[model samples]
Target chain A: MPAYRPPVIPASEITPRSVYLRRREFMGLMAGAGLALGVGDARAEAPATVPLKTVPGSYKVGEPLTSRDDVTTYNNYYEFGTDKADPSRHSGDFKPRPWTITVDGLVGKPQTFDVDKLIADLPVEERIYRMRCVEAWSMVIPWDGIPLKALLDKVEPQGSAKFVAFETVVRPKEMPGQSGYLQPMPWPYVEGLRLDEAMHPLTILAVGLYGETLPNQNGAPIRLVVPWKYGFKGIKSIVRISLVEKQPPNSWNSLQANEYGFYANVNPGVDHPRWSQATERRIGASGFFGSGRRPTLMFNGYADEVASLYAGMDIRANY
Target chain B: MAMARSPFVDRLTGWGIYVIGFVPAAASFWLGATGGLGADPVRAFEQTLGLWALRFLILTLAITPLRQLAGVNLLRFRRALGLLAFWYAAMHFTVYLTLDRGLIWSTIIPDIARRPFITLGFAALVLLVPLALTSNRLSIRHLGKNWRLLHRLVYVAVSLAGVHYLLATKVLDLTQVVHIGLVVLLLGYRLVRSLIPRPERRAA
Candidate 1:
């Protein structure tokens, strides 16, 4: 079998930003027209009216960013629901405004700050990163965010702190998945990273995507972006940031310890229990059975930047 | 009893079941073509076919119980239902091999060995092959008493299919639990019916 290769689109073929934005506008117009015809409610949420401003980031990837439609529509926010489309549909009513993230536990200065205040304090930059899902699918995303180290420096972690635990808001009314008796996952979806990983320059506290404020489906307001790790490690809609001494329990690890390890680095050698991790289907790249499978890279092709973090640990065991 | 009925109605009923059986496959194709299968259309298509196969297997198993308890004879349509289930199972396996795995034998073989769910599902498909081949009247006439013995493999096939679905899902959601529950009820009814004595009845 041939080694997995990403289809190379010529640089000239890459869609220009203006044209892409125009296409989105045209789609919005079509949807409006459909709505006027007394058809089902068309998605009317306009693209970010105010263009998000970002400085150049050093951690830019060479790969083109996945389309905004794919990034926004195809999400894994279990709070909204498990089905990929459920988040986009159900998260419309979600209130991402007036959000606050509380920084506490094992930090010298524990404080609660408004999300807007947090974004205002730091320099937001655009960082293109490859996001690999545990389900053997991948996407390249352009994220707008401040380096996580900037925020961690403000909190001032104590010497005893070993891991940083992140928690998302638990609002059953806003998140329909949490309201039902049949819970797909435990409430207050939580994730944790080692103190070093949390403080890495590459780690980002994302607030926007595709030159716009983040959509509710794409974890609006504030979310973590640990590019090297599986997408689930980057928890969405973060509410609490706690620096703890012990390894904090995460949602997926708590749910299935064997399947999901704390350090979910994308390693091709370590296969998931149900499926092989060696290859991943690139969403929107091709047809159903077309040439889309690409070889998964170690640490999602960020091994040089992140390999030093796990020098002695066995990846298979950790995985 | 089917012969006593009008030839037109019997032919229509048989053809109707056959046509309706293709709906799941057709719907899956339509969903894929129209982008209705969500973000990962290939995965959605594979799962939809697999679920339908399991559903048809359960429906096929329920036919005997429905006749024994409720006196609703659907034996004439049972062959069509069994063949339909096998067809879906074959399609499910085909999609898994072609679309999902890309026919990577090195990985696929090891996956079957390691993953019990895949093993069970493969076993179910393998068992159905012989039964599907011998579904015609010529095979029944040739095998005589042995035909009933060979077709008994369906019970094992259905059981393996149930376990395959349960293990594959991992999560014990209501739908998975209900599917397994129905299979267990059907198998239990068969066991009880076999134990009790019954008056002689003409075999279909």
Candidate 2:
């Protein structure tokens, strides 16, 4: 086999930190952006489970560890509660077993697969990506997961499948916030992706994070982990994926269409309604460790990869 | 005027002040945890602490007004509440200097220069320093009549603090309006009362 292929602009040319963040940014900017600073904490050190080799970085080769604060405090899993820290403490009850994802509508061989059997096909990889919350805070987490396209490929899509819809688990006993909304609720949490975005290499079907079985707060059992878009795009504890011809109504979009569109890519230039999107507070960058936060990036710094997908279209419209 | 307070009452009131102070802080943490602190909590936290500081300021301002209106004075409550107001204001400035700007002077300098609210906030905080310093009984006795004059600056400081809170929020929240109304009433009452001469019997 030939030696590792060089990127278009040689590897040395790019800022190592920025490139690292971009890869994870594709995963959803904050998941593992600045973390990997030090993985040798005096805590549980599980052997690396993912197939991907751990290169030279903060995390020990293949060993996975979690920041107690990240696991205990910062969480985007909204089922347990709306606060960032609430889900971490309260999402202990989300049951992930006996789960199945509906694969009907625009796909061939449409059927449900027990989540375990589905993930059994691909190996989970350890990736460090920047996970940026819309609130401007961020974290660089080392997550264990597989490419989303690998799963999408298993259940081939028909030509009409222009969009992919995802829905979350609906048990109120485990996930209490279902009743918060006054209107009649949709059984499962639903999120959709345009056909092309669904096929992107960086899209992940995450089963675990911090190299351990997922804590309910981080979306257990199975979840979609899209790195580039805002954290909201990556639906958690999902139960269904229905491919359709048009965009399905997304949770945030339905509530506030203009502010949260289907394509919620992280762009520092495009500001959110209540705050600036120009920069983010990168959670765990080195030197600044325990000191200060870092600025956010454009397209979550993945503009080079995903920007071409929306060449002539106006981002402001879809945004 | 009985000044006898049992130790239990003193202890109970101390705990009461602490509980009242903790309520806002606890609520802030809860709101932050739930994402109810809004999209940017550094700013939200700043606004919150500023509001608390102003509340303390109003509380200080209310001491006299409440005494005159109710015919019962609670001047003993003044120092504790004044210190609590200063504590919250300190927290507000800390959040502003640290989290919001990530502790970078570059980010803050421009903000202080361009934003009038920030400028006013800094000025208010600076002015509070002397008042807080002179808050002790030692300083009060040493300063004598000058103590009254020095403490009067609290009225100016509070007004600036209220302006700081209002201008910093960027939006008109009814809660803020209510706070401003209280400040107006407290200061207004004092002004109106001072203007009235002792009524001599007006006989023809």
Candidate 3:
């Protein structure tokens, strides 16, 4: 594994002098008003208006970002429903506020964090990423959040912790897909990452997108964002984060072991058993009649930074 | 007794079937043009066409079963329904080629050869060709008893289309299961009908 090099991002380089000054003033005002707990309610009600004060993250892809409408509407949140349009339509009743994330399991300092407080305390940044789905569709999104490493650092992983497992909150009353007689998959949807992968600079725990708090359909409170892997690896509406000794089970991998593997890195070389992964339809890239197929990249174009992590291992066999 | 039967009614029903059969394809095209198909319009558009093809194939297969079991004498329109299924299947294939795969022969060829669902769909479409060509009066008159034997391929084609639909879906949800169930029931009816001895025709 590559030695974790601390990114040398001077504070001034991340935010403008005026915005930086205002953020400190804003934080002071926020603390005085006891606003940390109530912030999620206000943000949830009107996300577009109350813009997040964010620094520009190290990674920013130059591609045109997908429209917020499409980003929110076209989702694969099976908790809401199996159809792409089902999430946006059915997630109206989902309550993302009053959320607590439990971080434990092989950690030195196990703790539960109120999601809003965590967002308020940490410095959020905007990182534009190319999200490639396992279904052969791609989108460029500007995600706003802190690096997952920063969150992992808070609890201090134990020596035995080899993997980081995550779980989504199960609220069947709101999430119709979970309440239905025939569920898409076993729920409290679970996902996991290697400890190193979780700590990678590129992995983030996103709270918002497009400079606004995430909409209900888009994993409102918080979600994982690993730009290098297929979109499914970045589990949404995360509730519990556990540092484990053994390789934890992934929801899709558990459902179809032959089709979905633990390491679902975006590789055109490894095709899904049902369909080819050689190319993907770039959402909003082309009109109805035009070809939207774009050749997928190795590790979703993060190969330079991550290729060495799996240098000795056979990717095809692992895939 | 009753008034003389109007010959125009049969002709009108046949024309109506053609018009009604084309609506789904037209509506899908309009949706794609108007941005109603949502993100990944090509996929939505392609799947819609494929779905309509499957629906029409099921409708075509139901005609004989309905007549045999329920005494619904709709056999005259069976040719039009079968032809409609073929046209929709043809359109579905065209869209997949021109839009979905962007007419990439290398990828399309491999998908047809290797992918089980695609191969089954391709075989289904291919089987419909001779049946569609022989649906006319000329071919029927010329071939006599052989025409009926050849037309039995419709059952095979419809069955393949049903299986293709089932395998293409990532998950076997209730909606898909219902569709596949209908196909199985119709095919099973055909099998049961063949085994039982036919009753003698009543003198008209």
Tens-digit per-residue lDDT, B98-120, candidate 2:
76666777556755665566777
Deviating ranges (above 4 Å) for candidate 1? A1-51, B170-174, B195-204
Docking class of 3: incorrect
Q: Scoring each candidate complex against the real one, what DockQ results? A: 0.13, 0.08, 0.19
Q: What digit string (tens of lDDT, one per residue) describes model 3 on residues A1-319?
A: 1111223434443334223222332442223221221132211122332477788889988888998888988999988767687687667778888889999999999999998899889999999999999988999999998899999999999999999999999886667666534466777889999999999999999999999788878887899999989999989999999999999999888877888899999999998876788888889888798878888999999999889889898999887
Clash tally, candidates in order: 0, 30, 0
Residue B174 alpha-carbon offset, candidate 2, angstroms: 18
Chain A TM-score, prediction 2: 0.75
TM-score of each: 0.86, 0.62, 0.88
Per model, the share of native interface contacts recovered reads 0.19, 0.03, 0.39
Q: Which of 1 and 2 is ahead in lDDT?
A: 1
Candidate 3 lDDT by residue in tens digits, B127-149: 99999999999999999999999
Q: Return the lDDT, model 1, position B49.
A: 78
User: Which sequence of candidate numbers ranks them by DockQ, best first?
Assistant: 3, 1, 2
How do the candidates score on chain B by TM-score?
0.93, 0.87, 0.93
Best by DockQ: 3
Which residues of candidate 3, in runs, are more than 4 Å off? Answer: A1-50, B1-5, B197-204
Worst 10 residues of 1 chain A by lDDT: A30-39
